[model samples]
Target chain A: GESVGLHLPTLSVQEGDNSIINCAYSNSASDYFIWYKQESGKGPQFIIDIRSNMDKRQGQRVTVLLNKTVKHLSLQIAATQPGDSAVYFCAENKATDKLIFGTGTRLQVFP
Target chain B: SQTIHQWPATLVQPVGSPLSLECTVEGTSNPNLYWYRQAAGRGLQLLFYSIGIDQISSEVPQNLSASRPQDRQFILSSKKLLLSDSGFYLCAWSPILWGLRINTEAFFGHGTRLTVV
Candidate 1:
């Protein structure tokens, strides 16, 4: 079965540094992708999204990069803060209006 | 400015008990509703999605079921709960394009924590 997956289960970084989370998807038909930030005991919050047409989209301090050729997606966060520590997930939009999610990567920002 | 509301922030039920979790969307009409489950230290699993009233799709087979009674309300239910069903459940809504397609991104609610023992 086609699936979406992340490269790391946990990523540790220092405050004020840039953090990158990577994802790999197997479905070529997916046209849209999203990154979500989930805190403990809360729902996932929308961070950024990118369509297949464009390779990169930037928002605030977050950037989403999509490479259709390699079926890869990434989220880059600048100036990582303590509040930015959360589980990040990459989602692929399937044809049925469903968002297939990856296993998630726990981002730990330490001072 | 659409917001999603899911009830019962936390719940504890015994095995074989009935369950009902409700979600509603405000400030948006004809939005696509979805139910997703996330286990501890895991990613999200899509359980159900609804484009409109009575139009729901289940992604995987399980002891749970979902319904869209109204345009803005989505409900997840189970006749008998299983220990494996314990997890954090989230409700989300997305804009509908031309009443047939869904938008790129989805907004999510706070979520419900279910514990079945």
Candidate 2:
């Protein structure tokens, strides 16, 4: 069975520091990957996505890096803020149009 | 612009009781709809998906089932519920862009929290 997983269950960072979250997926056939931010009592919000053809993609203040050979993916957040505290999930897009999600890493930003 | 709506924000049900959760999408036609369940401290698990009206594909085997009566309406139902079925349920939609290419970015609804007592 193919699955996606995170390297850490929780990550803490200083408000002004940079944050990095890591993920590993087992499905080699996946063609697309996405990162989502989920706040309490809310649905997962799409932050950024990268296609298999590309190794890295950048958004407003976030970036997604993918390593196909290692089956690894990572999300980087610059200048972490208190508002960035939430659960982050990485997902892989399967051929069936379904997404396989990782358990998620809770990002805690301290002042 | 597309939006997804899922309701009753919260629900409580007893064992062996029937359950029904509804999800609807607006402002998009012929979009792909999906149902996902997220347990505490876990990731979202894909339960079902529909590409068109009355066309559904189930990912995992369980006591639950899903249906798409209309292009924008999807329903998750169970004849009898189990305590393990209690979790946060979400509905999402992604538009099909450029022929059969499915959009990688999916929009999600608020979500429904189910507590089986």
Candidate 3:
């Protein structure tokens, strides 16, 4: 069975510091990966995504890096702010097939 | 812009009670709909997905069932509820072009908090 998992269950970071969250997936056939942020009592919000073909993709203040060799995915948030505190999840799927989600990593920002 | 709507932000039900959660999408046609359940401090578990009206696929076998009555309407229902059914239920929608699914991210609703007591 294929599974997606996070390396850390909880992460604490000082405000203005860079935050990195790591995820490992077992499905090599999955070609699409996405990262989501979920606040308390809210639905998960899309943060960024990277295809298997690309090694890295950057958004406003976030970057997603994928390493197909190790089946690893990571999300980097620059100058992390207090509002960046939330649970982050990484999901993977084959094209448009069902997306498989990993246990979320809770990012806590301390001022 | 497309938006997903889910109702009953919070629900409290007893054992053996009937349950129904509704979700709908606006501003999109023939979108792919999905129902996901997240337990407290857990990841999202996909329960059901629909590619079109009356077309559905269930990922897990449980006491609950899902139906797409209309193009934009998706419903999760159960004739009798159990304690294990309590969780945060989320409805999501994604774009489907020419019968092919796209890479566009799925948009999730606010989610319904179900507490079966």
Query: For this target, which candidate reaches the highest DockQ against the unseen true structure?
Result: 1
Better of 1 and 3 by DockQ: 1
- The digit string of per-residue lDDT tens for model 2 on A1-111 reads 899999999999999899999999999989899999999989999999999999999988899999999999999999999999999999988867777789999999999
Model 3, residue pairs in steric clash:
none
- Over the stretch B1-117, how does candidate 2's per-residue lDDT look in tens digits? 777999999999999999999999999889889999999878899999888999999999999999999999999999999999999999999888876855487889999999999
Model 2 sits at an interface RMSD, in angstroms, of 1.3
Q: What range of 10 consecutive residues in model 3 chain B has the weakest lDDT sum?
A: B96-105
Docking class of 3: medium
Candidate 1 local lDDT, B6-83, one digit each (tens) = 999999999999999999999988888899999889989999998889999999999999999999999999999999
All predictions: root-mean-square deviation over Cα?
A: 1.1, 0.9, 1.0
Candidate 1, residue B51: Cα displacement in angstroms equals: 1.0
lDDT, residue B68, model 3: 97
Give the fraction of reference interface contacts each candidate recovers: 0.74, 0.70, 0.67
lDDT of 1 by residue, A1-111 (tens): 789999999999999999999999999999999999999988888899988889999999999999999999999999999999999999999867788899999999999
Q: Highest lDDT: which candidate?
A: 3
* Residue B38 error, candidate 1, Å: 0.6
